[model samples]
Target: MFSDKSCVNATLISGTKETCSFFIFEAAIHWAEEGHRVIYIAPKALQSPPLTHHDRSNPSTEAFKLMRFMYLPNYETLVEQLVDLHSFASLPNVLLVDDLDNYIEDPGVKDKREVHIARLCAILLDTMNACAVILKQNVHICVSISSECEKIYQLYFDKLWKIEEEDDGNIVKVKQVAACNAANKTYEYRKYGSENIILKQILYSQN
Candidate 1:
C-alpha cells in the first residue's frame, strides 16, 4: 500500500481483530510474489486451511515458499526473534507481525504493562535501524494491531494505516492515518470477482 521510497522503519496497520490477520496475510503474499522474501510472525498457530480458503489469489508453491512463517507464542519469544534477526543467512525484504496487541497486553504483565510495551517498541525501532545502518538492508516492517492499540504503538511507526469494512463488507476502506513524508490519503476498494474475493482499488483521495 506504500511506495518503495516510503520509510519502512515501522508501519502500523490498524483494523478490527477479525480483519487484521487476513489482510496481513494478503499483504505477505503480495510482497512475496513481487520478489520480496517475507517473514510472517504471529503468537497463535497459523492454520494451513486458510491458505487454501483465502478468497484472493492463492499463492503458488514457489511464491508460498518465499514466505517463512514463525509461531512465537509470547512477547518474550517475539523479542528474541527480533533481536536475533541479523543472524539470519539472508535478511527478509518484509517482516509482518500479526496480533501485536496480544503481545503487548498480556495478562501476565499486570504490573508495568506499559513499560513492557515501550521496551518492545524500542527494540523494534532498534532492529530496523540496525538493519539499515549496520547491515545495509532495507527491511520493511509492518505490524497488524487492533485499532484500540494504535495510539500506544503509532509513535514507534513512521506510517500508520487504518482499515475498515463498509457497504455490507463489499467495500474496504484504507486510510493513511499518519505518515512521516506522505500526504494523508484514503483508498477505497470493491470486491470485483464473482466470489467477491479480489479487492480492486476504485477510489483514492487525499484527506
Candidate 2:
C-alpha cells in the first residue's frame, strides 16, 4: 500500500520468539509486489541462505524457488563472507535480518563479535526507512540487542522502539516500547495486541 519504508516510524511485535514462516515472508512479498526493494538475510547460523544467486526473479513465490531456498551457503562460508555491513545497509529499502541473535550472533566468540555485529545493528537503526525488522529467536540476546539500541537511540535516533513479549501464556501480545516526551522524561513503554499494532499512535509517553 505504501512504498515509503521510511514510514515504518516504529515497530510492534510479540514478546517471545516466533517462527517467521511463509505468512511473514508473504507479508514481505506484498511489500515487494508494490515495488518496494528488499534485502533479506538470515542469522549467521540460519543466515545460510538457500542460495544468493538465482535465475528466478521471485523465488519465494515459486515452488522450485522454495527448494532453492534450501540450498544456501553454510555457516562456515557465511562467517567468512558476511563481514561488510555496508554491503547490507546499502541494499534495497526493506531488509530482513533473521535470527537477530545470529546476525550479530557468534556461537563461540567474544564481545569482538558483538562489537562488529552491534555496529551493523546500529547502522540499520540509523538508516532512514519505512521498515527495518531484525528477527531474534533468543529473548536474552534480543534483550541484549534492545538494551544496546535503547541507549544508542538516546544519543542518535530521533525515536526508538523495543518490540518484545509481554505474556507467554493465556494469549500472546506484541510489546511496544518507545521514546516519549513527558514530565518524567523516562523512555515510555507499552504493550499491545497484534491487531492493535496497525500504524497508529503506537508510540506514546508513559509519563
Candidate 3:
C-alpha cells in the first residue's frame, strides 16, 4: 500500500488484458474494504465493476465510485476527467487510472510532439498533486500504464513497478524500477486462482 502524497505507477508489461484487469479490480476492493472511497477511471471497454465484500448497507462503510469514459469524438483526456471529479477530494480516496498510456500518444512532428507530451504530463501531474493536497493526506493515486509508455509516466511517479512475464513463461516478475535511495529486487508472481494474485520478493543469499 502507498502512503499519502505518493504517486505510484505500475506498468503492466507482457501481461494480458485479463491479468491487468484482475489486478486493478483486486486493488480497488482491497482499498475500498479498508474504508477508503475508491474512484476508478478507465476506458469503457476495460472497465469492470469492483466486487466489494464489505457490507455496503452499513452507511459507516465507505463506497466505491466508477467513472467509465468512452473514446468517442468527445472523449476527454485523463486530466479533463479528474478536474470534473475534484469535489471528491474531501474523502480519503484511491484514484485509479486503468490505461493512462491510452492518451500519451498523439501524432505530431519532432518539436510539436515534445511540446504536446509536456502538456499532457503537466495536466496529469497538476490534477493528481492537487487532489493529494486537498485530501489532506492518505489519497492514493494509482496509474496503470503500458510498458511502452512507462518512460513518459516515470517522470511523474514517486515509485514505479515494472511487471513482465519471466523467460520460463511460468510466472511473471515485478521489479521496482525506481525508489528513494533503496535497492529493489525482483518479486515473483504467484497465482492462487483467477482472482487471487500475489507478488513475492525473491531473496538471494549472500554467499
Best by lDDT: 1
| Candidate 1 per-residue lDDT over residues 101-155, each given as its tens digit | 8888776666586677778877876665555554455777888888465356756
Off by over 4 Å in 3: 1-17, 45-77, 88-92, 106-114, 167-169, 179-181, 192-207
The sequence of per-residue lDDT tens digits that candidate 2 reaches over residues 6-109 is 33432312222332221234334555565555444444233322222112255444332211111123334334433442245333444444444444555554
Q: Using Cα atoms with residue i matched to residue i, what is each candidate's TM-score against the true structure?
A: 0.79, 0.44, 0.65
The predicted structure with the larger lDDT, 1 or 3, is 1
Which parts of model 2 have CA positions greater than 4 angstroms off?
Answer: 1-14, 19-27, 44-91, 112-114, 122-170, 182-206
What are the RMSD figures for all models against the true structure? Answer: 4.6, 11.1, 6.1
Global Cα lDDT for candidate 3: 0.52
What's the CA RMSD of model 2 in angstroms? 11.1
Look at candidate 3 and give me any clashing residue pairs.
none
User: Candidates ranked by lDDT, best first?
Assistant: 1, 3, 2
